[model samples]
Target: MDIKDKLAVDVLVVGSGIAGLKVSIELAKEGKSVLMSTKTQLCSGSSFYPLKASLGTQVTKNDEDKDLFLQDIEDVSHNMHDKDMAKIYIEEIKDRVDEFEEIGIQPYKLSDNRKACFANHGRTIYMLRDWNKIRENVTGILENYSNVTVMERSVVISLIKRNDKIIGAFLLDKNKELILIQCKAVVLASGGFGNIYKHNLNPNDVDGSGHILALEAGASLLNLEFIQFIPGFTTPKYKTLFGEHTLNYCEDFVDDSGNSILDEILPEGLSKEECLEVRSTHGPFTNSLVSKYFDIAMMKQIMKTRSEEGFELIYNKALYENESDFYTIYLNWLTERGINLLTDQVKIAPFAHASNGGVQVDHFGKTNVAGLYAVGELAGGIEGANRLGGNSTGACMVFGKRAAKDCLAYINENSFIEIDSQEELNKLNESMKHFSVHVDHSLTPNEVIDSIRDIMWFNGNVIRDEQNLLSAIEKIEELRKSFNISQFVDNVKDRKSAFKARNFIMLSKILLQAMLERKESRGAHYREDYPSEDERFNKRLFISLNDHELKLEFK
Candidate 1:
């Protein structure tokens, strides 16, 4: 096996998002040799991907409302969040926001009359600068850290564990060569699995590989059933997020056939105006509220038509003259992007936006595995059934810093294991041979991935039931059985695609199994067969792999 390179570091931070950046900075500040390997370039990930102009982090409105902020999170998520984790986030978020401002990524200067969206009360919204600008500011700060070495275009195929401790990781670089990095600790901050769905708003690199890597490394993932789906544009521009602020002004919600889509799915006695008003209050789809029919109706139309071209809406901006400061800024930003809601017939569909759950971690972002930690969207427990809008980014800051500081004790006590390049190369050789070995009539990796996306987007997204979940599981199993990595050892793109295909299969199966096991509707996870939340399943559910078999348990 051609092992491209071998190196050593005190810590290997996987990802380049807000969390990954924060972790690398903290470790570098402590003078620890840190290698930050990103699947893409710096400032690339969900955190820096501009989905909407009004996108920002949420914090407590005031110190007096700290308890209320926690209450809002609990109420919004249906009390499914980890109480301790939520508490940690609430206490630490203000400081993190301050750090952002100090680092030159300041919040937008909105008028005092600007109204908050998403949460009911005690939650203050800090409108962010353009995501591109935020990315520039963050990357600029990272440039000053001389102790950190960045390796881009690297995908972690797996971790190297000895006696159940993470000693290093195997990365496939852009050159299609395996690079091994021996480290005392591995921190996974690789965002979420939104891209696994055919329609999603996450960056292409957010493929849930971190979750799979942690799981295979003997870590548990929590609440895989809860994924947030929100509306995004389907025509003119693909995968652009559709903000809900304009929905209240949109009068005609129709499909290409000129049929009223929302009217078809709206419950009896519920006016379209009332539904739109409630739906505009939140961005993500939730079963706990009546506004859910908005997303359901959109998904129904797409599923019924089986076409990527979704439904359209006509907006009359003149209907509402006194727009909130938030709405005015959002509209202007949309105009800057060359989208005019009044002149444009906007087409939209429910797109997989974020995941509320991931690898289960403690308050310090330490997983069950001793030397492996998970932070950011890769780590679960901060948000539960549904995520509060801004907590996603907030958790990244809080846990990222915490993990970096906490892992020091472990690194101080432990020394590097005595594993050489040849020993690691032998293992890599066996893995490559298993995948590259010829098979009869094998499908391409992209083919398998496309099929996986279709199954996930249709059955596991927006709407779910017993039959469809089981069907998806069966189809996923068939894909797994048929997925023989073609002889493309020297092909870099194809090799990465092959690994991504494998990761998607593992992630899809876990998500489908979790959805089926939940057996009730809760927040973002709605099961039409059991249309109400069951208290028995109220606790967080966790999944782990043992002896290559998936096991799930509820806490």
Candidate 2:
């Protein structure tokens, strides 16, 4: 086993999204040596993906409105949130927003000063002034820190733990060589596993490798079942996010068979107009509202047809006046992209947009493992079953800063443990050989990924039941058995894909297991067998790896 290089830093940030960059900037300001490892380039991941023209970061209008904001979060999450973490997020979000504004990520003020998101009340949604500018600003800020080392195209394959504490990590660099990064503290700000699904709005690099890294390093992941599924375009272009605001003007939806999609699937007593109107208020699919039926119908039609091309939406101009600034901006952005809501035929289906569950962390982003932390979409607990639209970015900012400050203090007192490269290299060699030794087929890594995505999008997707989940778990088991990692890891790119496939398969299995365990439908997680929320399952299900087996505990 040939190791490329060995380096040490005070802190290692395993992502380059808002959270990773935020924490890096904070640590660099304190003169700490921070290594920011990104799978791709800087500002890449769901945080900087240009699917939306701008992202809305939430803040309260006044101290009086804070209680209402908290209530909204609890209500939308259906009492499935961390009460303490939620309160802390609300208390610190305003400061995070102000901090970003100073760094040129200005927020666009609404005329009303407050607007509702996902059924929340008095929520002042500060749309980031411009998505591109925000990316440039963050990238520039991170670059200015001489103490920060930005290692692009470096994927963290595994964390190096000594005595149950994170002392270092093994990074697979762009050259297919291994680099050992020893650090006093590690921040797992890596984004969520949206790309594991067939259709997702996240970047290709947004796989759940970070979660697997943490799990292997003896960290627990919370609420692995609560994933946010939303509508995304399937035609005209793939991977484009379907704006929920368009639902307000949705007159009808027709499948590829030229039949009304909502005609049969709409629940009794819920009219098409009423359903679409209710669904238009939020971005992600939720069982807490009547709009859930809309997502259900879309998913059902897509699954039944098994079509890559989704259903078409008939737009009604009379349904909306487009008076709101949010609507105007979104509509104009669509027009600029050659998509006319009224004239164009828009095809959409339920796409895996984001994961509301991830590595379980406290308010300061500390995981169960010592010297390891998580933030952004990678960390869970602050936003429970379902996350509010803008709160994702807010969590990144608040928790990212908090984790950095806390970990900086840790680094000041603690010293890095001895990292043995020879032992780690021996393990890596054995794993690589084991990966190739068992394989009999020559399936490309892309094909393996496609197979996993198909299984997840079908069985473990929005609509789940006992039978389908079992089928999915079984299929994933078969796929893992058939796919050989080393048969395809001949080059740098191929090696990366192999790692992604392995992580995706493992994470998908865990997610399906979580979905199967949580029988009751709540927020983002829905089960056909158990159609209602259950009080017995209100607590978060934390999943961790122990003795090479997965363990689940409720807290």
Candidate 3:
């Protein structure tokens, strides 16, 4: 398990998603030796699954100004978003978009030579190609860089800190052997905590590894309570079948019985355009008779059908057969694009997709800790509450570039400091041994993880109350106790699988604890008990560990 013979680099980028890859590309272009690690393979993160769209307001002469964009973000965030950090993100929007174009991302355009608009911003752009194609193109470019090294199937176990600064990291390679990667700078582009919930759209590997790493390293986190739950997804085994792009096309919302509820909310025969006109007056989800009609009775019917048929009925039919039904139906109406969904109804429900709250960092990506920087989903306070639909891609590009810029600057300004790999190995060995002793028969990792996800979905979902939150905390505590005693049948190499489950449990607890503390319904942190948004809790909520205790403070 010793890594004394391992290699070293100038920069270490963890998680090979868009954020990490972009930073590695930028740093490699600058002639810095960059090493990027992926928990699985490159492009396996959430970035690859996006329906080929980029969201953001690029700097322009008309429509949206930097100040106005900041205002919009602040308004959505309820002032919880860090103004300074948001300003940095706003200032870089145009440059980042232009950079993407320079790197071969040809965006689709309207006849007027402008990108299509979405979410009150004109900067939203859709890719003319598929998302997987974009990832392949970017990967091809990255492979050409001589200074960049790609380590597939490597997991960062812990950050190596020296004198309150990050020196490097202890990594577990594919074979589960410990290897120490010494680097002058570390960029955590590791994505969000969506897997903490049971019915999430995020990958199972995304167990908030980066967040927990930052917390263990004593870095600060903000806005943990603001988990966004997107509306407008179909139910009966929820799946995110439709991209928001189809919002421009579809007009009718159907209940489980396939009955159109549009007339119930709107006057009979009102066109989709007309519905949009009065949508502002009636409120977002309330006016949509479709969401209203899919009530408890509808859900009951779907459950009955599933019980009788031994398969879930999603849309008008079973979803798996009509793989592209939702996409096809919407695209055909929206842009004349063709898609096919078989029997599936494109079942959907809003679950946590991304984290707006993460390790606090400055414009340069420097966290409160001296040598540590966060990028991508790990770096928070930029998007605030509800991230604009396509803005995530832009944010990753901008912040990833900035983090590399600052990291390279740090490397040039400072001298290399050697770390003691033996000491780190000793610490890791002891920790591994402590967990290894619990090999007795008990709950499996999968069972414990399922329990954690179900608890989160039930208690910490879109609507919350003090009672549910408290009950969730108790449930999480009980689960954690079970996890501590859980046994793993797998060997040492597969022990990380068990550890991943444990990590999810710990993060779920933190998320619940943070959500319970926030007593206001601001942005995504909606508490039904405290239904109204409170002016007093208007600022960002900061959570940090104080002597093993989760401490809450407002920024």
Candidate 4:
């Protein structure tokens, strides 16, 4: 009941990644009091991974490049993206990139030769090699804005909704006390639920709580079925994502038994060079590629190993002479593990890299729920099925700013109305009372999280079938029965795990149910039962809660 940082602000941004940070800085610059809260450390989300810099976007030198870029996004989106949003994103984002460049945070072209940058697609992407420096630059500017109050370890427990509008939120401070956040608007940039999978690059804190909060507040999520599965090293030290270009050096994607998985699936027309170019452009394995069959084989192999290494990415060192930047990272990763990049074979598997769909938002990051906005990986529809390489970071900058500007406009026109604090507090208190009820003594959040990972990896991973997805749903439902939030609240030691577990469970059910609804393969959500993409199922799937019942629809 000890309220901390309970002061009012024009906007409350729930996250600390590029999206959240961008919103806070933008609004604060305009002299609006902005509260940016994170569940963990300031720079600990997917954006601030300690090991390596996440892939970023390329700069478009001219209008023609921009046009081609738009087309590329549409093509990769499987014609399912919001066409207007794509245009708005490309045109509006250029200015943001220019702003970054002016501020000394810049990106380098992925390849040396500009003309034949990519044979499969005629384009070059820019990646920020000095990610830490750029991160420091952004965070540094944010400090100059005294209007931005950043709170770490402050998680948004739930939204305070009244009369179909989001008026405030219940925040859990570091002291584990309830803080009623009364604000005009809330921008959710809480990142993705990659951690929901057994193998992922997401930190444990990045569990899908944002999605859960949106659902509880009457927001609908679109395209929840499209989770991008990219090949990354999952052993020795996990979640080391190979640069897409670096993976091009991989002459073959082989298995431990010396079987060339690529050989088994490589199309008759696609040469080894063409195969590399296509794979490099599209980071995740796609059925669109002639070599997509390799991904299906890779998924099977990874599952077959279950708890061990299975695939070897073979590369010819001679071919790597021209590759410098990306090759260095790949080489360093191997060298650190005492394996020679030139000699030792690397075993990699598909990782839940990014979520293509999230809380359905408009061009301005406005969700279905009024006064609630979502940005970054938390907002969906930007990337339809599989996202283009390095677009995640740039899109965050673009939409985060848009959300801030729109939220500010909304707040200026609409005054912050006072509400009954006692009523909201009582609602939360009632939910907390259920924590200790009907709890099994042996059941813990860790146990539940592991079960979720196992089920999702096996049934809801790179490839899926009806039987496994339905089984996953059943298993998740049964796990929910064994443990409840009251159990975690009663056990203070596992409070964090319990809350995070609830979010993961919510995300798992949403994803699986969406998968069940979509019978055909499209982009990343692949169904083995329906092996081919169907025009009938070309629409996006939407998930939302109606009277606590999960409802799914597609159009």
lDDT of 3 by residue, 138-216 (tens): 7778767878888778778788788888888887777776678888878888888878876566776667888877887
Q: Give the alpha carbon lDDT tens digit for every residue of 1-555 in model 1.
A: 367888899999999887888887878878898998888887678877877765567776667878877777888777677899998888988778776653336775333422344576735666665667777776677678777888889888889988888899889887768888899999999999999998899989999999989998899998889998988888656787777877777787887778787877887999899988898888889998888888888777666777778788888867347476657767776777787777776898889978889988889999989899999998888787777777777777788889988998789889999676777767655654434435576667888899999999998889898999999999998887776764544565677888898788888999999999998999999998999999999788889998568999988
* Candidate 1 global TM-score: 0.95
lDDT of 2: 0.82
After TM-score superposition, what is the CA distance of residue 312 in candidate 4 from its true location, in Å? 2.0
Per-residue alpha-carbon lDDT of model 2 for 1-555, expressed as tens digits?
Answer: 357899999999988888887888888888999998998888779877878677778776689988888888887777667788888888988878877753447776665655556645756777764667777777677667778888898888878888878899888887877789899989998899988988888888899999999998888888889999888887766677788877777778887667887888777898989988888888788888888888888777767777768889888886347777667877777778887777777898888888888887888999989999999998888777888767888888888889988998889999978888999777665555534537657567788799999899888888999998999999887777777786666565677788788887778889988998897999999998999998998788889887556787777
Which residue runs does candidate 2 get wrong by more than 4 Å?
101-104, 319-321, 430-437, 487-493
Which residue pairs clash in candidate 1?
none
Supply candidate 1's per-residue lDDT for 426: 74
For each candidate, the alpha-carbon lDDT, in order, equals: 0.82, 0.82, 0.64, 0.75
lDDT of candidate 4 over 478-528, digit per residue (tens): 887777677565555666677777777777988899988889888777888
Per-prediction TM-score to the true structure, in the order listed: 0.95, 0.95, 0.81, 0.91
Alpha-carbon deviation at 525 in model 3, angstroms: 1.4
Model 1: ten consecutive residues of lowest lDDT = 108-117
Instruction: Give the residue spans of candidate 3 off by over 4 A.
Output: 1-5, 52-64, 101-104, 109-118, 121-128, 231-238, 243-346, 429-440, 484-490
**lDDT of model number 3:** 0.64
